[model samples]
Target: MGIYKILKTAILSLFFIVTVFSCKPKKAQNENLLLSKKNQLKKAFRYPNYLNKNYILGKFDYMNSNNFVIVPKDLSNKKIYIRKEVLVAFLKMQTAAKEDGISFKIISGTRSFAHQKRIWDYKWNSKYKDLPPLERVQKILLFSAMPTTSRHHWGTDIDLNNLTNSYFTKGKGLNEYNWLLKNASKFGFYQPYASKKEGRTGYEEEKWHWSYKPLSQLYLKYYNEHISIEDITGFDGSKYSKNLQIINKYVHGINSELK
Candidate 1:
């Protein structure tokens, strides 16, 4: 026990296991770009806005690891999850859009009022029971999200890489939507269905969604100060959740500097 005190207790137990995982959060940057502790526990996790109806059809689809996380790296093999600060600004904007080639890939993220009530009861009783619950809620708001005003039940949204918009346009989905419109707001991300060419309303024009606008602007200002529409009912077209204006046209639709 004395060869220089057993090599100084094995170099202080390998410097206490590399200073406890060098205080964690890899996608690295203490390469001294700093920021770790699992990206500061992914900037301190906090997802909520289940907007009650027994926390949206029973504990927001098994409470995705209790307020979501998952995305260690599986751009879409499956699990995905989201808000650990939107997977650390989407893996730092998918590793700075793969050094110019752009490859960001999450197919969709977060959704649970019992997974948007089985996608609003498979488009309301199998593809719009023959339209007219206010034009099948305007053709399921031209794409979806009626289950408790979904911003994917607020895990700071994301649907990226290509869910259509003709996969962005042309080459590498028009260079991944022009490298997410010139570097996704320096990494906080936006694009909540922007172009109606210019007008914007309810939905329609979701060029592969995105939104981590610094924690989906506090869950869209706490679903506009504590959600209503009778806390957005249970399922099956949810009686068009109180003749839907859906909190000023789909919960402040978006893009206007993310409300």
Candidate 2:
């Protein structure tokens, strides 16, 4: 072959090889970028109530995520889970209460669906078992919640120093109660179930139950919008949820200040 033609052929082959290799990496890089975005979208959809029902229904495990923190021993009678933001506010409130010479403990915090179910089942098989189903449920509802319907599931409500209403009626309990009534709201907390004499429905007066409104209020909004009586199954007497207007008279029944 002529020298010029031979050199021309070599140059053409070199250009072809360089072009093919360069095109391959560009194609591969494009594919990798697309895959990365898809994975990111999946992760984004996983958070902030993915199913909208899971978190509110107590299906998610806050213990397994950074979204919750353990309640400190001094603040609670037992190790309990609470939302991180709620804990921060409570600590501030605790300090303020201490300065006023009043003190309290957290008797209960987050309760998962399974944990609540155990409570419900125990009561279901208690002496009330002999009573009619509706009556039995009503009796339980006086102070207890029906599993998924509980605000405790949200990690934003805590049962305070005492459980009995009489405890907060006078003496030290009364002092503590008065303090909370006067100052708890400054920390984004509020009593959920107030005295029936005030015309509030749902559970009986529980002076100890305080909710972190900033977060629980949002969760409550989600629960009302996403949850229905049909979703409140897996327990005895669940069929009566609709008849009892559990969503309205119960879930929606809160201190008007909370609304």
Candidate 3:
């Protein structure tokens, strides 16, 4: 072919490549996968008023109900929320468990910073106020996140079926927990407080709490690299945060597999 024809063919080939590439789904970008540690931190911190969802502390994830979907009343029984994708995964898990004569419920799901504070303060005022500030803090952290730091803020962590180990020891709770242990991961769920063969610290072993790993991993990374004890506040005994070294001992002090 002549030079013009050759150049024309080359241009057409380039155009075709560009068009096809553009038409293809934009992976990573459109999928919202946070694969890079650095980029993950940047994106986590960049959300506007992100702190507002869980208070100004680095404990809560940003909320856009559009990113969340209301769960069916049968699954949750009470009004509850979770990340939209997480809701989908839970539905699938629920369906699978139903096949095995196991059913599940969301004992607790998404919680905003305000909701967490209410839980924290209620405990502080009613149950543990007589204890030393440090002891009180520890008592709460045994099962609760300080106001701004609860994983529930992410809408990916869930409290399921029952919160007690005894409940999971026998009967339907046993079946449910077993079903989850065997199957939740298939739907992207994980227990965040199971004890190791030897021992572990931080929160007591909560047999009920499960996190959606894909997004919670990113959130945990944000907490590890960005949040500090000093950054937590708006609750009783938070001033003891630094004294307690909550940043490492509590916030990061979770099931190692979770991290």
Candidate 4:
């Protein structure tokens, strides 16, 4: 009996030591990982300001800001703003595409909340005005984002070449589209609104819209975690935001590859 008791005590002690040591390391590792992620986000994006939904919602002024740069007139049709990191990647990609004889232009770029609001309001008060709020918003959402929920607000997305789908179906536009498909990812760009047939959510297939995944993906993660449909307000059809599942179905409903 004495021998058995000693063995049992020894086993219990060993088990306790193993459990304590194993649990402590796991806890410490998790804490360290969380701290690392926080630090990385802060160092890379300037923390809460850039990661915050207000920034994602286009509440911040990007004009003359160091973080944003003007798209050179040669690259875009009009004066447009784009994130510095995205511009760098795009410039590199543009050079490569130029070499390949597949040239494209930025038709649209960063849009502030006020700018997007103007777009939303214009369509809202247009012929669609007669429709129910939700239906009217739906019509706009098919192609446009409802102000605050737009990815364009992030400055990491752009519309390239032409806006029409048929434009990319053949000829020069098709060549550009095919080139983007073959190589855009090499520079961190991806189509966020691929065809529904690809199982992507949100807006219809916008062959023109390409996002800088490296930055936009992180911004999207922050937006999904922090922003809610209720946070979307100050627009004509703002009330319909929740019913439309704008946060989930629109803002979060990007290309899975992006997610």
Count of residue pairs whose backbone atoms collide, per candidate: 1, 0, 1, 0
What is the per-residue lDDT of model 1 for residues 1-259, given as tens digits with 9 covering 90 to 100?
Answer: 5799999999999999998787774435564355456677867875554444444323455444565777655587567677687887788888888888678778778776677778777887778889877777678778788777778776678787667798688987888898888889899888888787777677888878988887777667766766777776766656665666776877786779888
Off by over 4 Å in 3: 1-64
Candidate 1, position 189, lDDT? 88
lDDT of 2 by residue, 54-109 (tens): 78999888789788899988888888999899899999999999999988788899
Query: Which is superior by TM-score, 1 or 3?
Result: 3
Q: What is the TM-score of each candidate against the true structure?
A: 0.30, 0.80, 0.75, 0.83
Best by TM-score: 4
lDDT of model 1, residue 13: 99
TM-score, ranked from best to worst: 4, 2, 3, 1
Query: Which stretch of 10 consecutive residues in model 3 shows the poorest summed lDDT?
Result: 47-56
Q: Which of 3 and 4 is the better model by lDDT?
A: 4
| Candidates arranged by lDDT, highest first | 2, 4, 3, 1
Task: Give lDDT for model 2.
Answer: 0.89
Model 2: how far residue 3 lies from native, Å = 99
Which 10-residue window of candidate 1 scores lowest in summed lDDT? 50-59
Where does model 1 exceed 4 Å of error?
Answer: 1-82, 103-131, 149-151, 159-164, 172-207, 210-237, 240-259
Better of 1 and 2 by TM-score: 2
Which residue pairs come into collision in candidate 1?
Answer: 25-38
